[model samples]
Target: MRRNTTFLSAAALAVTLALPVQAQDAPDAATVLARVGEAEITLGHALALREQLPEQFLSVPDTTLFPAIVEQLIEQELLHQHKADDLTRRQRSMLDNEVRNFTANAALSEVAIAAASDEAIAAAYEAFAAEFGQGEPETEYNAAHILVQSEAEIEEVAAELDGGRPFDEVARERSIDGSAQSGGDLGWFGEGVMIPAFEAAVMELEPGEVSPPIETQFGWHIVRLIDRRDAQVPPLEEVREDLSGEIQREAARAFVEELRAAAEVENLATDMDPSILGQRELLDD
Candidate 1:
């Protein structure tokens, strides 16, 4: 059996094939490419379809892609013209949803563009650095502690350490906290991380000196300061992308809030079953 194939007009295919080599200097998008019935397919339509092609298709040569894409657009135009007056309820509903989604995206793009301008991004970066950057090198502490359920347990652990038993050995045998297995090593941390009382005790201890039992909500603690160092802030370039994203999100949120405040909205479904959201069949008709 000989299978039949629908192909584009020979002249149209020749013109499309030549487009790849001259793509950089192609005519204006308004130039007409083909016509299906009364509907016209323009260069813009072909370019838009090309943009939406899957990533796998991107590596295809432009010469090969140009005619194929144009043919696809012509086929789609023909189908659209044939079905224009016979759309099903589902198709109409989907078109309405797409219109809403694209409109919302267009508005968000405007907000993002204004928010990400060079001047706006620079100002945001300045503000973020002033608020969060360390103006001077800040101190970090390396410390360890033995946590116990009762004051008596902490006292016993402290006494063993004073009597020349190793701090890690004492912690492994007596501490109840999660770090006990790792010799109660808290790793390096800055101030404001531990509870107020615990931090205060840690700050007061000299390296190699153990504290008397300190009380916190978690339990009693014997802390040993191991070392300390000053940490510097990262360069602005290292964090610019994060700052720009934060500014864009804040701007979009503010824009949406302004629109919401000026609009009249009502919750007509206040009494409706919330579980109705799980019923995809509701969109059927």
Candidate 2:
């Protein structure tokens, strides 16, 4: 969803989306919640109508909510009583401004949403798939190895492994990687998840085979391939909303850039020091 920057400075209020109880068995004042001259409207009736407001409006604080709503209700009632046959010039100007702002925002939003249509999303998916080749892909392993700064230590661990000692036990007692506590299990991942050299060593082995001192940036690795699988595409339903929002944002950004290109905006102080502009701050109130 778009950021609600316009409403950030608006008054705070608690919103309630519930119908009020009738005063049939209670006080008379409750039955006459709204009084405009001789006319009267019940609190219960207004509360019942409150459900029609937007969810955000229903969540405002009562302190700001009640007065604003009361004023609006009174105005609406008065306007109904004395309906204008035609709008005044000022009214037309105000309405024109409102319409212009609304149309601009609406058009931008509609363009963004339309860019996320199923066909567009499907094309994006196809592009990603193409990069991975047209066959079922292999799952790559992701693991970190810690190498001690000694060769003898590597040999001692290799011997323990040859003697059927648990791999995790050897790693905890010897391997310097932070993952030693977790048996050096680097978590599940797809192919190409590791550096090319490191990945090559792991891919060569069977699930239980430990490598013979393969070296990398950190040091030598006693590699183990715990698991492997054919990679698969996730179901579209699981990512539909994510894909839609991403597409919408891209569309909006492109529209903004296009507008910028067409406009002839001038920077009067373009040659002035950049620091001058950076120090200016607007007062909130």
Candidate 3:
């Protein structure tokens, strides 16, 4: 099916193929190639459309592509001009959204392309590494806990802990939770298990230190940070894509802020009935 389409594209491009416009012999872009009613499609239009062609169409010979592009532009113009001037309110709204989306994306692309220079990425990596403990592998902890149904039970466990009972021993005897059997060992998890109240409490404790009683939905927890080990952080090259996106986002945010600071803006709809947004018939007119 695609082969036939390719053949057709090549044929369309070749229609003007009486002579292939080699790089040296290229005609002026302003030269008109065809007419539809009163509108002229020029060589410039064909060349520009060819630049935007999808990869599959590009593989076709320039001879084939030239005619195909011309055909495509002519057909598109005909369809566009055939449509009445009276676009529906909904259509105009959608077209406005598309235009905004394209322009905003193009602006962001420009920022992203310019921001990811080698020096910029290197700088970003340095900052990132510093924030990430200066390239020290992040630490993952092995922990054990005694979970009990009440504050009273937790205090008992704390007393036993303070009295020098081993955490795993205490866990074996006092923890009603499953890990109690394993001395509450949650083996290893990385950062984007990112954060949580339970994890926060865990992080604050030095290995072998017992936490003050922590209350959670499960019950009271007497947690011990048993041991911790370093977890790998990817090298800069490995995470270049992620860092590039971050750079792009940061640049985009700064650009938007500059625009906001320079522009005069007003919002007059604050008191209006937001429910009116649901009225579909409003667009019918």
The lDDT for every candidate, in the order shown, is: 0.79, 0.66, 0.77
Collision count of model 3: 12
Model 1 score (lDDT): 0.79
Per-residue alpha-carbon lDDT of candidate 3 for residues 79-167, written as tens digits (9 for 90 to 100):
76887476789878876787788788888788878987888888988888777775557778877778999999999989998898888
Error of 1 at 23 (Å): 14
lDDT, residue 156, model 3? 91
The estimated TM-scores of all candidates read 0.59, 0.44, 0.56
The TM-score that candidate 2 achieves is 0.44
* Model 1: per-residue Cα lDDT at residue 121: 74
Give the per-residue lDDT of model 2 (tens digit) for 1-285.
222222322322233332343446664535655666776666554554454456787776665665545544555566655754466665555567777777788888989878988899888667755765676666756453545557777777778889998887777777788888887778766766776777888788777677787667777677777766666665677567777788898999999889889999787997888787464342111
lDDT of 1 by residue, 1-285 (tens): 111123344454445453222344567788777777888778887787777666776786788778877777777778778887888777787777777887887898889778887787778778876776556667788899999999888778877988999999888888898999999899888888989998999889888888889999999999999988875444667777887788888988999999999999787999998998898776675
TM-score of candidate 3 against the unseen true structure: 0.56
Best by TM-score: 1
lDDT of 1 at 20: 29
Candidate 1 residues lying further than 4 Å off, grouped into runs, are 1-26, 133-229
Per-residue lDDT for 253 in model 2?
A: 90
What lDDT score is found at residue 10 in candidate 3?
A: 41
